[model samples]
Each structure stands twice: as C-alpha cells, then as structure tokens.
Target: MKVTKTSSNITYDIEGLDAETLLSLYRNMLKPRLIEEKMLILLRQGKISKWFSGIGQEAISVGVTMAMQKDEYILPMHRNLGVFTTREVPLYRLFAQWQGKASGFTKGRDRSFHFGTQQYKIVGMISHLGPQLGVADGIALASKLKNKNQVTAVFTGEGGTSEGDFHEALNVASVWQLPVLFCVENNGYGLSTPTNEQYNCEHIADRGKGYGIESHIIDGNNITEVYIKVSALAESIRKNPRPILLEFKTFRMRGHEEASGTKYVPQELMDMWSAKDPLLNFQAFLKENDLLNDVDEVEIKEAIVHEINEHLEVAFAEENIIPDKTEELNDVFKPFDYQEIISENVFEEIRFVDAISESLKQSMEKHDDLVIMGQDVADYGGVFKITDGFLEQFGKDRVRNTPICESAIVEAAMGLSITGIKSVVEMQFADFVSSGFNPVVNYLAKTHYRWNQNADVVIRMPCGGGVAAGPFHSQTNEAWFTKTPGLKVVYPAFPYDAKGLLATAINDPNPVLFFEHKGLYRSIRQDVPKDYYTLHFGKASMLKNGEDITIISYGAAVHWALETLKNNPDISADIIDLRTLQPLDTETIYASVKKTGKAIILQEDSLFGGIASDISALIMEHCFKYLDAPVKRVASMETPIPFASQLEQQYLPKNEFEAELKALLAY
Candidate 1:
C-alpha cells in the first residue's frame, strides 16, 4: 500500500555505494545499449532473424539486475537485455543465441528472450510475458521454504500488467509474503498499442494496493535513481520476505522489434524521450560527479564494441545445430529411468481417494522438499476430501493452500522446478483447468523441449461426471492436453492404478497431468499395497483376457466396460485399462487388436477429436490385415455434459456401450 514516486527533476544524493560500483553500473548499462545497436545492424544485414531493441530502457534492467545478488534469480522480459549483460552471462553464448547457433542456450530451438538457463540463474520470459511473474513467485517461495536469503526479480512491460497472470501472481505472492521484487518496465508501448489504450489506472503501480503489496514508481531513465531505489527495495524484500511492486516509467526508443516500425509514435514524444535516454542521462550524471569524462566514455564504448565484435565473430563461425530426427524426438521430455514398482505383497483394501491421499503422503515423506498446492487443499483438505489430515501431517509449508489462481499455481510449479523442487498441483475440478490452460500448455509443457529445463510438477485433475454436477464441473477433457507435446497424461481407473500411477507421476521429471475421476473416488475399493510402489506410464493393464474382442478404455469408463461385461457374460473380451493416455501404450493396444481382430474403444469424452480417434487410427495403421471388421468407438455425444439425470445418463454413452459392443460382435 505504500507508494513512492521519484521526481523527474531531482538532485542526486547517491548513498550506500562507492564510485567503483557506480562506474560498473554505467559500464553494464552501456554494454547492452551498444549490443542492441550492433544487433540492430546485424538485423538490417539479415545476420540475425529479429531483435527486440531495449535501447531507451537500459536503466531498469541494469539497475535491478546489478542490485540483486549474483546467486539470486531473475526472469527477464524480451526488452530487458541489460539483465543478461549485467548478470555477466557469457557474451559468446548470447551471441550464439542471437545467431541461432548450437552454442546458444536453447540450441536454436528458440530465439530472443524465449529461452532460460538455470546455470546463469536467469529464467527469461516466454512470448507470453505474464506467466514469468508466477514463475518468479515459485522461485521466491522455494527460497523462503529453504531459508535461503534470495530474492527473485521478474520484469514485465506495462501492457503485460493487464494480463490475468499479473493479478494472480501478485495476489499469491502477497498472500504468501514471498521474497519477490516485481519490476514493471513501463515502456510506453506493448508492441504497437500505446499506454493510453492499456489501463485506466493513474499508474500501473497503483494496482499493487489491491493485492496489499508495497508499490513504487521511478524515473526509469535515471540510472542513479533506479539503482538507489531498487537496491533499497530488493534488500528490504530479501530480509523481510515480501513482494513489492516497483514501476519503472520509461519509453521504448524504437519499435517493439526491429521488424515493426515506430511510425505510430508521435515525433515530439519520441524526441522528448530521446533527450531523456537512460544511457545519455547516465553519462551526464557520471560527468557531473567527476567519475567519467568524454575520454573515459570513449574507451568504455570502444572496449565493449571490441568485445562484442569478437564474440559475434565466434558466434557466426559456430555451426547452427540442425537437429536430426533423433535429437528432435528425444528433446521433448527429460529421459527418466523407469523403475518397476516392487510390491511387498502386503495388501489392504482402500478407497480410490485414500489411494491418492496415501500416495501424496508417502511421496511427501519420501521427498522432504516436495510440496502440494491447490485451492482449499490445506485445512479444507480439498473439495473431495482427498487431502484430509495432510495439513496437520505435512505442515503448511509442504501442504500449501493456494488462492483461486490456477494459472499462477501452475506457473509457480514451473518456478519450483527451476529451483529443483518438485510440486504437485491439484485443480479443484478438471473443468476449471480452462482458466489455467495457457501456463499448463505453453510454459510448463514446453520448458523442457525449448531449453532443456525440466518442469518437475504434477497437476492433479479431478474429472468426469456420474453425480450430475452440471456442465462446468464435470468434464473429461484429457484429450486437450494429450494432444500437447512435452506433457504426460495419466488417468487411472482403479484404486490400484490410481495409487501406483500417482506415485510415478510425482517422481517423474516432466509436467504430468494426473486425472482422477470423481465418480471412481469412493465407488471403487481395491486391495493395494500398504507401502510405496510405482507404475510405469505408456503401459496398459489388461484387466481381463479373452479372444472374442478387445475393449480398450480408461478412467471411469474402464469400470463401465467391466460392468457391461458382467451383465452380458456371453461377451468375451480382452479388457485393456489405459492408466496413461499420453506416451500411449500403442504396443499393448496393437497386440490386443491383432489378437482379437476386433476392437472397440470407449471414452467418457465427446467423440469428436477424442483420444479414441487417435487410437483407432493407430490400430488401423498397424493391425489392419489382422482385423476382421472395422474398429468400433463408443463415446459420449459431442455436446456439453448434461445436468439432468436421464439426459446425462444418455449423454454418457455407457448405456449405449452394451448395444455398440453387441453390434460389433455380431459383425
């Protein structure tokens, strides 16, 4: 709620730092500006594909990054090139990155600020600028939990302040009182839209009061003011461990990217900002303080230009790693050693919910750093009561109850992964995932493939409908994520599969979507191990073996298939329960279909564009000659799940499953 605005015209009273540090800051600021100018030249020559020029806004990136400790983390935006330069990231690697060479951070998988490296403690922003805010919160949360005196500084533009992620991340960080410095570089324009079209608030920092966090605004063009204010604020946050929103009011001297012309910006405004440029203003400050003169500035600029040219030559000489098919295929997810779960043979009967709860409990005990976060998950023990007694047993630090910010929660999990901490996120209901889909699909799912960064998080989705919970709450939307690469989808049907697969998912080094059917939570009980065990993904469990036909299904539909067979004992089948939808068990499916010569795929999701369609195609492609009839698919109608009991029952496709099976057998 506290706000401070530095005046545009103010006398400098530099405090708490010596002349050497001041000169270093000037050098850091100059290097990036020079680098940007050089990169612009290369862009014109078609040497680099594109460049997001941060010409006018060097002070914000330089001051914030230089103010933070070397060991601390930073998530820089596209225009914050000074952050990387200030952090002393190797110039050769950066040049290689700009040139899309193999030596680049992402090995040409991505360019610009679309990559991140844990080695440099710099996790850059994806094209979606706002998600990195939540990621910053996660890293700060990890620091707090581990008692590490590290503060994370994350950058975003003024336009990104309007994203839902901005609010959600701030709210979560404030509620948790995390050690995070939220830096907003108000660079006048987001791409082409001016600040007038962005928000109605007096200033972007004004919105910080709504989240109960401290706020500040500064003349971002003044490097001295930026360094002094941000240094004090970052130190305060590091010591007290709370988020503070700092808005750096600056202007984008050039277009968003070189390709986009700045014709929309008024010449007078551009001229006004040009005179107040960060580099020029800082040079004047140095001269006035007797620290730097015209000759010293020339030497510094010449040295930086020489350094950049040498690195540029090396980067140009390095071959761009054109990934072969094998490398491209292997990079999607980190390779994990698959371990078979060895059971002690001691068994106990428990509900499906208990199985999940026990798996989480055991995993938390096994991995001291493991965290479980979701809405109402701590004291409320989740809406399904799956996490009952977890708060008392695991404590609040490990069993975190998050605000209703699914996007931030998922993003925080990604941050935790960056710090080598594993997390499990529970979506209150699978239907609510739409709100958090962007981070799940774009950030967490793509981190590994993009930069070799492992997103070690498990997102638990409570899905499906049998209790008539209406359209919004009941959804079997696994197909949405299954189609997304760099994600593993696990949906377990029985208590046994649920416990085993959940354990495996928590330990996996990739982002996993673990779907738990609400209908099967208490309705099914099975004898599972009292001790820990894991089940491998992409391996289907054959519940029943028969030669008549192959019945392939998963989640609640596996139960539905078993019940249908019980009612009609005349139908013989090889019932395959797919515990994991992605990294699909096509080998098992092909084996079943080839042996049976007739297969029927069952799903609770709508028929169109469902997992069944992909499976049917795979069957036809591999086992075509072995099939006696066309593959059959029985699915819920292509409509939103209904609320009425009769209509819902008809819409579920369970009743029609029997008829479909009989007809397929007759053929």
Candidate 2:
C-alpha cells in the first residue's frame, strides 16, 4: 500500500501543504461564509425563501476536497460549503440554486449543491440523512470491482452515526475494502440534540475502529491538518479500497437550516469560537509565513464577492422557472417505449426458473456496466441457484454476495448509478424488498427531481404467489412499487418472454423493478432466444387468437389462461401477456378485447387495484361497444395468500381461468 497510516493524535502538518494551498483554504472558507451570510440576509429580507448555512465547519471541505482529483466523486451532507466550493461549484450557482432559478441545477427543481456535476464526477448531494453513506459505499464498491481509479467522499453528521445506514455502509465498505472516505462533521450537534444525546462514542473516528478500518479525529477547524490527513487517507483507500473515517471536531455555528432563532447557543461560547474561526485562523497562519499580504487578501475577497453577485444577477434576471407540471413530474422513470421499438424475441424450449437464471447470465455477459448483488447470489449460486456459476464465471467481485442489508444494497445501487454504473439489485426474496423501500421510494424515486439528475439503476426480485411459498415468502407487492412512478415494473410469464423482457428492462434509461415471480420460475418450458434480444415495455403478447373472449393476464396467470383455452375450444380466446405494468399496454388490451367482444383480467394477486383493475377500467371506458358482455377479472379473493396447500390452490386463479371461459362460451 502506498498510503502510510498517520497518527490519530496529530492535529497539524505545516509543510506537506504550502503557502498557495493555505491561501486557497482561507479563500475557500471566506467565499462560502460570504455567500451563506448574504443568503441569510436575503432570506430575512424576503429575497430568498430559505437557506442552509455551512458557517462553522469550513476547513473539512476545503482541506480534503482540495487534495482530491477533479474526477473523484463527492457525496455531501447539507452543510458542506467548503467541500461543495472545493468541487468547483461556483458561489453564484449556489445562490442561484437557493433563489430557485431554472438556470440553477436541475433547471431549478433542486436546491443548489443537491446534484453534483457529471463532468466533474461529483455524485448528487441527497437531502435525506443516513442513506447517502450506503450510497457512497456502492460507488466505491463499483470502483473497486470495475478497477476504476476514482475515490468517493461521503459526508454525514454525528446524528447520522446512530442511523442504520451509517453502520451498514461502514461495515460493507470495510468488508469489501472499498476506496471510500467517510467524513463525519461532528459539529457537536445532530440538530437540536447534542452528540451526547444520540451517542456515547467519544468520537466518530472511534466508530471506524469497530469496523477495523483506519480512522482519525482532527481539529476540523485547522486547514493543514485536515488537508494532510485526508490526502493520506484518500491515498490508501484508492489503492486498496478500505473504509476510512475522518472526523472533524467542529461546531454548527448556525442553527439547523430553517428552524432558527439563535438564543439556544450560549453567546459567550459562540463569540470565543468565532474569534478562532477557520478563515481568520488560516489567514493569520499565511501572514505569519509572509505568504499572503494585505493586497492579495483584498483582491481575493473582492473577486469572490464579484463572482457571487454576478451569478446572482443572472439568477435573478433570468426568467427561467420550471412550469407547475414538471414540479410534479419529470425524470421519475425513463419513459417506456411501446411495442413498435422492440426487436423481435426468438423463442426456444426451456424451463421458467432456468429461463430466469439464463437471463441473469446473458446480462452479465452482455454489459460491462451491469452488476448483480444479493445474499446467496454468489458461491451458493442464489437460493434457487438462478445466479449459480456467476461468481465462478464473472468472479466474486461482479456477482457480489452482500450481508443481507436491503437498504444498504438499494442505496448502494443509487450511489453506484450516480457514478454512471448501471446496477441490478436482487434480494433473497421479494418479501425482502420492504427493507429497501426507504432508499428505493424516498431517495431513488425522487432523486433526479431532488438533485435534478439522471441515472439508470435497476432492481430485480423474485415475487408473486403459488408453489406453496406461504405468507412471508410468496408476495405480489407489485402494487407497492407500481405506485412509485420512477420505477419500471416487469413480470414475464414464459421462458422466451422472461429472457427478452429482462434484457429490455436492463437497457431502460430509468430505474426498473423487474418482478421475477417465484411461482413461475420453472413451472413449464418454452422456446427462448439462445442469442441476446429485448422486448419493449408498454407492450403485450398475443398468446392465442380468438373472437369470443379476451383473457388479459401476466406472470403465472398468463399460463393459466393458456390452460383454460385447452379445456374450452367453444369459447375462442385471445390472451395478452402484460410484461410491464407501470407503462401498461392499454392499447393492446383494448384492441384484443375489441376483437374478442368480451374481456377477462386475471392475476395471482389479491384482487382490489391489481393490474386487473387498471386493465379492466380501460376496457369499460374504451372498449364497451366492442364488448358483447361485461368485463370480468379472475383474481385472488381479498385475503392474505394462505399457508395451507389445499386453501392455497383454491385461493388462486386456477379453476376461474376455465370457469370464466365457460361463462363467456355460454354468453
């Protein structure tokens, strides 16, 4: 390792960083402080609605960030002015962002400092707490596996130290030995509660020791110490990818962003710390060495002030505000391309579970950007061994086996994608998707809007009922995620379609949630393409052509539809398999029902609001005249999926597939 470990107690290193660096540190601190002070005044004067201040802890951002390469990624907390400025974001951009101008990042939807520049390799700054730590973990892990030379810096507060994400990220980072710099700005408070209230640990650096990674506690106010220590830390992590903690002992000078009225902070302590501030301290150190004089100081301050106002002038003068529609919409999921865009799918005979596994193998072979992570996904070859041989074929690095932390896994996917790496996240079971919902729904779903960014992050899990999976394991929670717009939901019923749909979902420009139903993993066989191919979303498959009735279904229900047609030839059937739900194939459904003159929606999920509801609603309005009879749905009764074998069989859409057809035949 090229990185030599430094002492924990050391607080200063005078020469590794020289006069120019010191002045730059001083200049960096002053600019954020000046902008923050100005923005605070703007908020008070009604010129700006709100702002968060990074007043006291400036040196950590300045020192560590200045030492890093331009291509390195930075995942920052809310109060990281020095780090943000260090990453090349102009003071005016920050002001413009605070003022809510469209020219601002994300064309004005996100606050300034929310999304990092793609050109600069700075990852988006998420507003939510704790999760970004795990996000940073994923990025570093990607770099480690892909052999990329970039390092990632993740910021969090002492309060976040108590969060599960914080601990999970550190554990994963250290275990994987990922190149990550975990900077915890312990500004003595995690909001109103003191560090003492949230944790008993003496220092954030101490927590790193528990993970067996290198750690340091520095005088966060000292520019030289922060710079030299972090440079050394970054060097080691970059080479060997181990988690490192750099805890800056600083204070949050201003009250937490909007909830402010300063009386709670004792005046005397504030005044004392104000006198020893980072900018003033760095300036004095430079002057003592005769590296900076009165003339340079005056020019630097003037230049920064001029830049802030110049950006603000454009920000205020530009009438670029996002419209009300985009405020609620935009970048949720990449829009789904309908049927016309699909390359034809080639069919081959194979079992469904093996079909699902083969798709995983094909994707792993196809894209350098594609990656898979989950428990038993490696040597154990996955619980069902669908991902078996992947670790041997692609190596353990690519087919990663994680320690069963769903939130961390999902957050890592978010962070990894932020760095331009497309990820495929898997859980041992679909039931486990609950653990990852916070990052999936709150962070990943709203990320682009919140950060004003774009990324293609994918999550695939085995779901649905039947096969005696019981309550916890067999779940069809597509409704839970289908409600979240940014995520693409897919359910392929046959071997041929599974291979093609999985390929299509992988290529989508937005986050996709592929629902690989456990029930149909290997119920039967079909001809799937031996070569690579794709199937577009918002499209459906016509299983059999008929005139009397249309059976609309997905997942296992589609198979049931085919079985029903075998028993009843009198009722001619047209079965449509809805591969992707969110961007549904309404056109195909209506067209099929129009021709058939009657329609039936079938699903393996408990009735109310399933894909059947959405599909049936479209028919009642658009295809009513085409329908000779009322539309019907064959779905599980409104009850939890049962555990008993006989009840479970009776509970699902089995006999109904035939019964619905017979009813249509009678009509």
Candidate 3:
C-alpha cells in the first residue's frame, strides 16, 4: 500500500482505497447531513419528536463504519446517523424509527437511536450511554471465541468517558486482547457540560492508556484521516485481536437534541467549527483531488435530498401501530420449554451448595456456548467455594474471573446473549447487584421488548439473611428483579429444587435472576438426582398437602414455612413453595388457597414492596370467594438487617410468620 503524508507529517494509506470508495464516503456523509436538515424541518413542523444532530461530526461515524467490514458489529450512539445510512439500512426504516412507527426496529416502542437490530449488525445504545462499551466487549469476545476475525467499533461521547463502563470495558478488552475499537467523538460538550467539566484529562484517549490499551487522537473533521487511520487500526485488530481507543476530535454543530438549542455554546467557537465542517472539508478535499467536482457534489446532494423526500412521503403516509393489551403483555419474554424428567432411581444426599455446583457442572457439560464469570469465580472457586473445582474441570477459558465491575459484566452478559452465548454471572454477594442495577433493569430487561432479542443469561444472586451476614451481604432482594418485566426470578429452597431450577434457569430464553440463599447453602440437604433434570418456571412445588390452611413462600422463607408446619403438627395446611417468584405459580397458590379457604404469604424481604404483597393481592383477587378470612402476610420488619444475632433474629420473619400462619389457621 502507498502512504501519503499531510503537511503535519501524519501518514494515511491512499493507494489501496479506490476512487469509488472515496466518493462513497462523501455520499454517506451527505445522506445523514441532508437527512438531519430535513428532520430538523420536520421537528419544527411537528412531524418528528426529536433529533440528535450529527451535522458537524458525520466524518467520525462514516469513517469508522466504512473502515469496518459488513459482518463486523458496530454499537452506535445517538449522533451516529451516518453509521445507519452507510450500513444500507432502508431509508424508510430510518424514517419510521424517527417517526416512532411500528415498522421501525423497536416496533414503535422506543425513539431515535435507542434500538438495536441483529439484521444490520448494529447494537444501539441505551440512554445510560456507558453500558454499550461493555456490551461491545462481549460482542468482541464472542467473535474471538468463534474465530470470526471481526472487530467491534463502539462509539461514545466525551461525557460518557466519565462513566465506569468506559474503564471496565477498556480494562477487560485489553486483558483479554479482544478486537474492539473504542471510538470517542469529543463534541466539546456532554448535553450542556463542556469536556473540561466532564473530566480532568486533556484528551479522552489518555484514559485508555491507563487501561493498558493503545490510544490515538485523530482530526475528526478530515474524513480522509479518520477513514485511513480507523481502517488500518480495525484491520490490525482483526488480525492481532486487541483493543484500541481512538479519540475523534469533532464538534457537534447542533444542540444535543433538536429541542435543546446551542445557547450554551460560544458564538466564536461555533463559527470556528462551522468553518471546519466535516462535509465541507471532505467535499473540498474530493474536489481538489479531482475525485469530485461541482457537478458531482451538487448531483450527490440533490440525489440524497430527493431520496430523503421520497422516504418521508412514504413514512408520512404509513399508519402508526398501537399495540393492544395482548400484544403489549406478550413478547416481553421468549417462551421457555418446560421439560419434566422422570425419576431414574439414582440419587445422592447433597447439601444445597453441592447441588448448586452439580447443577452448574451438568449445565456446562450440556451447553458448549455456556460461560461462567464473576470475581474470584475461576481459581478461588468463588467466595462460597461453590465452584471449587470448576477451574480444573472447565479451564480458564470457560470459567473466567472478571474485574470487580458489576455493571460492565452484567451488560457484557447481555451482549453475549445477543450472540447466542449463555452466561452465568455470580454476584459474589447478592447486595452487590445495586452496582449493576441500571444494566439489569434498563438494558438486559428492556432489550428483548425493544428489539425481540433474547437475553439468554442467568444472574445467580446469593441472597437472604439468617447467618448474621448483616444488611449488605444478607439481603432477600428478589422482589427488585421480580418487578422488572423481562426478568425471571427463581428461588429454590431444597437441594433437589435448587439443582433442577438452576438447570431450567440456564435453559430459559430470557434473563433469570436465580436467588440462592447463603444461609441455606450448607444447612439444607436433599436426595438430588445425579443425572441432569430440568424444572419449569411459573410452576410451584407442593411440599406438603393439607386442607386446613395454605402457606405461600419461596427462598429461605419456604424452609421457614416447612419448619412452622412441622412444629404445629395440629395445623393441617397445604405448603406451597413458590420456586419462581416472577412467574408466581398463581394457579397453584389459588388452588391451594381455594381448597384450604385460608392463606398467609411469607417472605424474608422487608414488608414494604415485598413479593408477598403482590401474591397477597393476587390471592385476594382470584381466590376471594373461596377464602374463610382476609389473607394475611408475614415478612421481615421494615429495617435493614442488623449485625447482631439477636437483632437479626428479631428482624427475620420466622417467628412472625409462624404466628401469622397459626392465626390464619385458627380463623
């Protein structure tokens, strides 16, 4: 390849790139520029609700996208309209997305640039902006594992660099030597805050050096420089498989969105950047080089304007689809296959912790695409030693230890799931999920609903209190995830159920929050099957049968119900252990409540907004006529679990539950 040097001695390869490719780059930039202008007119006319202008920085998106191969993936930010246009997504589809039509990628569920599509190999960013970096790590990881030789280009703004995900994604990608290009388009301000207020570093690329990643700074106004540098870097990464952070020094000519005007930006600065606009500079370059003259420039822009007008007419004529009740409720989660396993006489008495280990081992043996990740999960066997021997058995590749980055790993799991890789993420302590809350609720839980993508990932949460682990470590936070629509919450009481439900959670087509009570890890034991077996979600296990009263609970509280029933032998009650909290097994609860005519819901989580509240309301709604008395609930006190044993004992729901159970029975 022949290299050409600029006056500043910056080199770019020009021989290998054809004239058609060069002209195509100009065309790509022109499409978004024209579309943005038309969309601004629409915004003023009330035809579209919002627009994130890529007016001045089209070179960055177009350059990076043209650099990447079609098979490779690109996770774009809000101002990356050039990426969508260059990728050849239909003009009508883009218009529909902007107009919030059902024909759009998210089916009118989300607005501009907030949706991802597998069809175009484009993963869109959530409003959080940072998690997509980690998601890019996962996509690159999948590509590396599959030997696809594909490099993922993930874009972020200067403000997003302040996010923890940027650090986490860079660190992991460098450590793993995955093929990822972290592109930062520093458009001077994040919303209204300037780069100076966002970070202390001089350049965003400086942070990547701290993560041990190779870093670069480019003249983003010059499309030739961006395309040449990014293309070379991407190709090198594809061959050598590593991460590089490139800071594209560009400017956003328009406001953050159409509604937010550029009043905060200085007039002189705006004029200075406008004079160096990427479209004008690139067009001038093409003309100077005799690649594109006045006629070519006018014809190219005219064609783009005509195309935009044609697409707008069609999009305006199309009717918007509003989802009805059934459509709205359905499609949040993909269907899970329920398989019942017959007893094979092979059984071993094992503790709950051992059953968990056995379940993971069996599942790993079954699924080749399955990966296990978390802090100290590889060699240290995790904090509780549940994976004590997994490193030796599964190898470092399968049983990988991650940095102490809860948010990034969770989003990475989401990224992996989109590529058909199933991941089991162990939150060392369930309380740490607070750090990953945004990714779980916003990204993982909502991705499927937005774009019909399956998040085939399971987050194993070691939750609940009884062993005096205090408030942070010991928390029955299943209710938090149960409230999220796309997530499945599973909490098993016995060793047999733990093993079986885990297998089912691993196989489920959506994200499952599998809660494992640390207190019950060693205390509970059962004759769990030696062979692989799967249980079904939305199904409750009938522990003991009675007709006097019904006890409803899950997790460690299910054991409490069992112990309470055992102590009060005179109280004949149907003990319903709800293995899955989200699905609720409402039918079983209703059946047992109708049969017994009395019910008491139990939980280890505090009373306010507990899963018990939902179950209680459900029983009252469905089993009202069959009840002998008003349904009662027994839950932990509305306070953080204490460190002292006595305070913890007082805070727990065991005694309270027993009392509530007896009172409901007597009524």
Candidate ranking (lDDT, best to worst) = 1, 3, 2
Q: What is candidate 2's CA lDDT for residue 216?
A: 85
Clashing pairs in 3: none
Q: Global CA lDDT of candidate 2, please? A: 0.77
The superposed Cα distance between candidate 2 and the true structure at residue 156, in angstroms, equals 0.7
List runs of model 3 lying over 4 Å from the truth. 1-16, 343-345
Over 569-632, each residue of candidate 2 has an lDDT whose tens digit, in order, gives 7667788888889778888888887787888888888889777787788899998887788788
TM-score of 3: 0.97
Lowest summed-lDDT stretch of 10 residues in model 1? 1-10
lDDT of 1 by residue, 1-667 (tens): 1112333333455666678887898899999989988888888899989888899888889988888999999999888889999988889899898777888888788888788877779998888878999999999999999999789999888999999999999999999999999999898998899998999988999999999999999989888789989888888877799999999999998888877889999999999989887777667766876778989989999999999999888898898687688888799999999777778979999999999998999899989999999999999999999889989988999999999999999999999999999999999999999999999999988889889999999999999998899899899899999999999999999898889898999889999999999998999999999999999888999999999999999999998999999998888899999889988999899998989999999999999999999999999999999999999999998889999988899899898999999999999
CA shift of 426, model 2, Å: 1.9
Residue 375 local lDDT, model 2: 82
lDDT of 3 by residue, 451-567 (tens): 888888899999888888888999889888989999989999989999998998998878999999999899988998899898877889888999898888888888888888788
Computed on alpha carbons, the lDDT of every model, listed in order, comes to: 0.90, 0.77, 0.88
Stretches of candidate 1 above 4 Å error? 1-11
lDDT score of model 1? 0.90
